[model samples]
Target: MTAPDLTRRLVAELVGTALLVTVVVGSGIAAQRLSPDDVGLQLLQNSTATVLGLTVLILLFGPVSGAHFNPVVSAADWLLGRRTRSGLSGAEVASYAAAQLVGGVLGAVLANVMFEVEVTRLATTERTGLPLWLGEVVATAGLVALIFALARTGRGALAAPAVGAYIGAAYWFTSSTSFANPAVTVGRVFSDSFAGIAPGSVAGFVLAQVVGGLVGVALVRYLHPEVGEAAGDVVVPHPETRSPS
Candidate 1:
């Protein structure tokens, strides 16, 4: 766990985010083609694929990058670890966010190429509204709180399936279909498909998600004040051990 190891961790984050976006965008495109007239069926198919794909990705990459494909998740991890020896440095957090953003965009591009679609088109699916924003806050808050809660309770092992299942359920329960990850949100902007979000809507969703992330952190503070024996552990190797800073 040194500078070279940090690079590997960042690569894992990048690759994991990229693969996740591929699953999301690819499945959405497939759902659109398979159920042209059935919106509900399209959603069903998309959500199912995302759930299974996400679970596998987390299990596959968690040990490498903590499987934090989401920017908010990385921030949360850093914040939670600030007082501990395992916390991520500011530089590492920045690296993770950058890698995830780049990865997400690449994933969208790969998905588009595989599906024979325009490679860099912007999404036009308008998802603007207070209700949807509220849904985003709720979805994101629940996600952040759930992840930290699990770690706080020494249940990191349950993260793969639990996190995946929560996202699949949130897709149905939330108005905006739970575009909870900022990197994922940015990635979806590159595709005009069932899972895509218009550029105009991205800011609002990102803002709501940020607010939700803050709320989630507060929730974790109140709900699990003391970090368990495994409190500082992440899905991947602890950042303090790998980061050069």
Candidate 2:
């Protein structure tokens, strides 16, 4: 795996991010429309649904590409020696990031349509700020670290379910409830539907995710120095492999 045929991975990110956000926001919209007072239950229900959807999606498509729906995951995979096989060259990363960004925006727009909202933010909706920002950093770091540990399980088929479970659990452990990916976060902005956040705050949220991603890689190195050399190294795929880890 020299460069990973990044276009494929980018397309994966695009489609995956689109689906992730659409479901999340779309559910939120449904909850609001159906029961405004039950916002909390609706969010929890939607969050749970998204986790299952993500798990299934990862299991299904993680192989066609790395399933790196987020740049953070890509960066962490590079650091962990797993994002791509050989095609993970610089071009791959950049293209994937671009596609994710575009996908995110497009997903947001689509959510707006389904929810019959314009510009995404409901105004009544507010994001948890600075403290939550730091929380994002911590939350995403834990997620990447968990990814690394499970990735080494040598069971690609289990990766998606494992990742999904981690996310579901993470919702309870962390303060911000783990937005984790800039791409997903940005897409949510267009909905103002269920889990929508203010577009104005997207920059800070992205910054936090970036920071968390790096921290996760660094933590992996610090905690498991023996495997550090393998970080981001590509491998040939097998039916057994989720994404060539």
Candidate 3:
């Protein structure tokens, strides 16, 4: 795609990520209020909503932006396709990251306003330590692997339900509750809700996620060595672009 196409894609990423963060933070807040006495119930409610919301978002916006919604995914795409003619450009990667980050913060603020909470309140949910960081690594690695694997195997159409389900499962299986998206991680910092992560821990989580993405890239290379061509979109299936690669 050309620069103009990239701009449109960036806009889609921004809007999709904004709505994603809203759903995550909003659902977490609602869960906290509804299940005040039950942590498990709160988690169940939050995860269910996230799964459904994410599925819808991907389906709705994948055609426009590939529905990356995650900085790591964009980074992975750029890194893997750096040598390819049709790969994402450095400028596109930068745009995607910036949009996702800003959208995440905006989404959190919107959620706060919708729920009558203080806007831009820093999160105090202390998520730290080796085990949780390890969980982040595992969660992020799996997510990256899943997306690339689907594309590599010509099953991109399954990204919506498959990724959503994987994330929902990761919420329970991973100790960190699967805050797999870096943009989402950063966004969560603006809300001291159930989905929020403390600002102090953001650096560690982001680092772990970066490492996880590298691990995922290695896995995709080892498992799908033949994935050289532009297998449709980077993260999810989108309407085929007729523009020159």
Candidate 4:
């Protein structure tokens, strides 16, 4: 099957990214007032919101943009060789990633203003600790890997719930509480809300997320060689990577 138009796909990605960021930050505000000590409750609340929000967003835009709201997922798409010579152009990838990045920043700003949040620790400034940072890297890796591994089924519409479920379940299993999304991570920087990341810690989190993306791609490439037909055709429009077929 042919890929959707590149422009539309990028737009879809940005839109999806925006929505997911909103949920991540928005929920934090709601939870802070609900219960301060119950991290588990906050997680359940956040993950449930994400699973539902993601399901709707994907169902709404997956056909148009492939719903890759996270940069890591986009990176994985190229790494797995999913794009074709005719898939999204290099310009499209760059533009799409840029859009996602800006959209994420915007989402964070909005969350801060909307919820009256104040970010205390931005990125590496906070001592979430090396262990926490590493955990986030691995948690995010599993999330994206699941997408790369599963998206090829071509039935991702129905498969979205599985996506939501895995993410929701991963909440309790891992220490990082499953950040799994770069856009969401960036967006969290704006809020001093419960789930928000410290600004100082952002660098470590992003790096870990990127590494996790690669790890997920490599594992899936080896584990699911039959993922998508467009694995190695290299006619990439993006200078950095190839499109997924």
User: Which prediction has the highest lDDT against the true structure?
Assistant: 1
Model 2, position 151, has a per-residue lDDT of: 50
Go through the candidates in order and give each one's C-alpha lDDT: 0.86, 0.68, 0.86, 0.66
Regions of candidate 2 where Cα sits further than 4 Å from its true position: 1-4, 82-87, 119-124, 226-245
What is the clash count of model 3? Answer: 0
Candidate 1: regions farther than 4 A off? 1-4, 228-231, 236-245
For model 4, state the Cα shift of residue 75 in Å: 1.2
Lowest lDDT 10-residue stretch of candidate 4: 232-241
lDDT of each residue in 7-78, candidate 1, tens digit only: 898898999999999999999999999999999999999999999999999989887778889999888877
Range of the 10 consecutive residues with the lowest summed lDDT in candidate 1: 236-245
lDDT of 2 by residue, 95-191 (tens): 7778877887787677777767876344335676788899889978877776665555444456677678877776667677778888888777666
Q: Which stretches of candidate 4 lie over 4 Å from their true place?
A: 1-5, 82-89, 118-127, 153-155, 228-245
Q: Where's the lowest-lDDT run of ten residues in candidate 2?
A: 233-242
- For residue 90, give model 4's deviation from the true position in Å: 3.6
Ranking under lDDT, best-scoring first?
A: 1, 3, 2, 4
TM per candidate comes to 0.94, 0.83, 0.94, 0.82
Tell me which of candidates 2 and 3 scores higher on lDDT: 3
* lDDT agreement of model 1 with the native: 0.86
